[model samples]
Target: MYVGLVGCGLVGNKRARGLGSNHRLAAVADKDLTRAESLASQHSGCDYFADWQAVVGHPACEVIIVATTNDTLAEVATAAIDRNRPVLIEKPAARNSKEIEPLIEIAERNGVPVKVGFNHRFHPALIQARQIWDTGELGDLMYIRGRYGHGGRLGYEKEWRADPRIAGGGELLDQGVHLIDLSRWFAGEFADVDGYVNTYFWRMPVEDNAFMLLKTIAQQVAWLHVSCTEWKNLFSFEIFGRNGKLQIDGLGGSYGTERLTYYQMSPEMGPPATVISEYPESDDSWEMEFAYFIDCIQHGCEPQGNLKDAKAALRIVEALYEKHTSGKSVRL
Candidate 1:
């Protein structure tokens, strides 16, 4: 398939590499022509444009990847869907749930496929964990606990992420959505959302820290926390079930080595049997996720991480923000 990528930034580079050898990046675009040109130069025969609309309308491009800022994600995606092009939008898909609602309607009306880039779902450890979970080895799920955070670099407050108009929200919308999506993936839809968001370190309008306590209709709980103030980068998710527990630690690279540890409870209680799996290789989640998106496009199937999933995550984010201001728990 020929791909058109909008946004020639860090994530855009990752998306380009994730195309693998089977697909070609035929067109690229960024507000900064030089950045687009630079990305285009890396892929032979790739065209560069300053206007994203041009990439969306490119004659040779079959699929569109929207890796632009939060504010423009829905806009670029809407243009592609309007042209009958499938889109793989970056996570958090929009500034808020409301921003993604219209895109959902447009895609459904056009029968266009749209996939949200929740690459973490493709992590090898998580994949194995899901297989184990599906086998019922974890028994009835009881609860989930997840914590993900990274320390911001010097002058980080000057980036687009620090600007509310551009980022929409702070750490919550940025990294918190990932955790929220993952939790929903494992446990199910949250029936109740009670959380708080605060700007602790970064002098930005959005919160630097977000804490959430979510519950399913069955009362199963998901305790999640996301922050940009951590001195050390970290990612940890633990799922507890009646028969055992699954704990996923790190995300490779700065977050440390990716590993999943499963504890199978003994009928006799006491110490349980432990199994650990580690993924020391570089992150291939982007490639795996892209491949699935392509498969969904060709098979005429819905992606696992579609706009609805993104909207669900964004709703949780919105609820948390609202709860913080209203001082009340939100019923979803």
Candidate 2:
């Protein structure tokens, strides 16, 4: 596959690497021409464009990867989908679901496949967790609890992430979206969402910490928190079910070693039987998601990270933000 990549920053580069040896980077684009050129230079026969539009319409490219800031995700993806090109857009999909609705309409009308970048779903531990749940050993799911946070670096408040206009909502829209997506994956779509967001530590207009409560039609609840105030980086997610429970911790690197544990309740139940799995290498979720994207394109199937999933996550996000802004409860 020939690819047109936009952003040329941390995530964009990761996407490029994820394409691996089978796919070619036909063109790269960034607001900074130098950054685009730098990425393009790494691959022979690759082209660099100053404007993202050029890369979007580049003749040699069959797929589009949008890794730009949150605000540009929908705009660039909508454009690419308008041209009948398949797109793997980095998530939130846009600043909010409102920005993504039109893009979804466009994609459905044109039958163009759109994949959102919720790469965490592809992590080995998560993949195993999903498999275990699918076997029905967990019985009916009860609730999920997740805590994800990171310590910000020097001058963090001044980054583009600090600007609500550029990055949309703060921690909720950032790492929080991953937790929301995971909850939905295990428990199905949420029917009610409520939350609080506050700039407890950062000086930015956007909140540095966020708390959420999501409930499904079945009353399966997810209580989650995401923050940048944690002095020690952390990631923990626990799911409880009638017959068993699953706990996933860390995400490799600064998040520590990735691991998942499943506790199955015996019928006579004194102590539950526990199973553990660990992933010690660098995160390959990027590569796994890319492979899934390619398979979806080949099989004419919608991706697991399709626009619908992104919309669902955004719905929860918007609901939470509404609750925070209005200081009232949010239903649906």
Candidate 3:
């Protein structure tokens, strides 16, 4: 794949790195031309552009990676799709579900696939948990609980994420979508959504903290929380099944060592059986997800984190925001 990346920020660089030797970084674009040039310089023959249109229109570019801010995601993706190019768009895909609908429609019309960057699904621990759950040993899933947060740095409130126009929503649309996507991965679509979001710490229009309780028609539940106010960075996700429980913690780096613990209920019911898996090294989810996207394109298969998944998660987000803005909060 000849990749063209837009954004040239941390995520854009990560996507370029993920491409590695297996693919080519043919072009890159960002609002900051210097940043685009810096990334493009790292790869031989890679071009830099100030406008994303040039990046997507590059004659040699076969794949597009849109890692821009929330507001521009859908616009760039739609442009790429218009050219019949497959795009790997960063999540929350867009500012809202409505913003992403045109991109999805364009992708389908062009016979191109739009892969959303829900990289958490590619985490080694979560992948293993999903595989195990698929074996039916855990029986029926009951509920899932997820907590993901990070401590903001100095001047965090002034970042693009703190701006409602740029970020769409606060932590909920940011990290919260990951939890919502993961919860859907385990328990399926959430038919009911109730949540509360508030700017408890950050001095921004967007909320710094959000709490959600989602339930499926099957009665399976997902309780999730995301925040930018946590003094200590954290990532914890627990899934309860009829026969056992799977708990995943951390996300490597500042969140600490990523690990998964499985507790199976034995007939005797005391202590049961326990198994643990830990990823003590760096995070490879970026590369893994990129590989999956490549495979999907090659095989003409539907991707795990396609536009539908992004839209589903975004729907929950919009619902929560609607509830919050309507002066309804703190409900079960």
Candidate 4:
């Protein structure tokens, strides 16, 4: 199948690369023709256009991939849906819930499929962990906690990612949205939350550090912490339950880490819990998510990263920011 792509930034390029052999990058569009051309060169026979409208409306393209700035997401997404083309929009789906909730309606009315790019849902370790939980191997789940952080990147400036007005929130929206969505995705729908966000450096107009608490529908509480200020990195998840506890440690780090640990501790006459089994290293999450999107487009199926689920993640993000900026408790 021929797939059209928009945005020539980091995620866009990585996605195009991941698509490799199974799918063809039929067309690409970017505000900057140079970058668009550069991206087109990466694909043997792809066409590059300055305006995404042309890319989206191209007759040969069956799927439109919107990987641009958050602010421009809705416009491009709406256009793709309008053309009756299936769309796979990048994570967060939009700047806020106001932008996301409506897409569900638009998709239903148009009878075209829509997907958000929350690729972490396809992470192997995360998938295995979810399987463990579903099998009740961990017993009655109590709490889950994690952190996703890293040093800010240089390319942030080349794109609209550094600007709050265009990027939506800051690191909170960029990285925080990922952790928040994944936390809830594993824990269940969030029932309530409280959090804080701050941008201490990066010379950017968005938050650089963010910490959040999520109360899931199952009454499970999870802590999600993210910061671009960290010198190194940290990515780990701890699940506590009635049986004992299971600690899963990420190997590499956020965005690149490909390792996991599944050590469980059980009471043994009051002795300290011991490590049981640890998972071997795995694949890069970026590649995993990208491959999944292309597969969805090829076989004609709704991506596991559904629009409604992405909207749900964005809702939690919007609520956190609202509470941080307005000084109110977010009940939902």
Find the candidate with the highest lDDT and give its number: 1
Q: Write the per-residue lDDT of candidate 4 for residues 1-332, one digit (tens) a residue.
A: 68899999888997787565667999999999999999999888899999999999998898888999899888899999988888888888898888876788888898787878777666676777777778776677788888877776776544577777888887778878777777766677888978888877777677888888888777788888888877677667677767655555554435444544555555563643454444445445656765676566567677666788887777888888889878885978
Candidate 2 on 158-199: residue-level lDDT in tens?
998999899998988999999999998888888888878889
Instruction: Tell me which residue pairs clash in candidate 4.
Output: none
Q: Report the lDDT tens digits of candidate 1 across residue range 158-197.
A: 9999999999999999999999999999999999999888
TM-score comparison, 2 vs 4, better candidate:
2
Ranking by lDDT: 1, 2, 3, 4
- State candidate 2's TM-score: 0.98
Off by over 4 Å in 4: 153-159, 244-246, 251-257, 267-287, 290-301
Each candidate: RMSD: 0.7, 1.0, 1.6, 2.8
Cα lDDT tens digits, model 3, 38-157, are: 999999999999999999899999999999998899989998899989899999999998998888788878889789999999889999999999999998989999999999999999
Best by TM-score: 1
How far does residue 34 in candidate 4 sit from its true spot (Å)?
A: 0.8
| True-structure RMSD for candidate 4 | 2.8
**CA lDDT of 31 in candidate 3?**
94
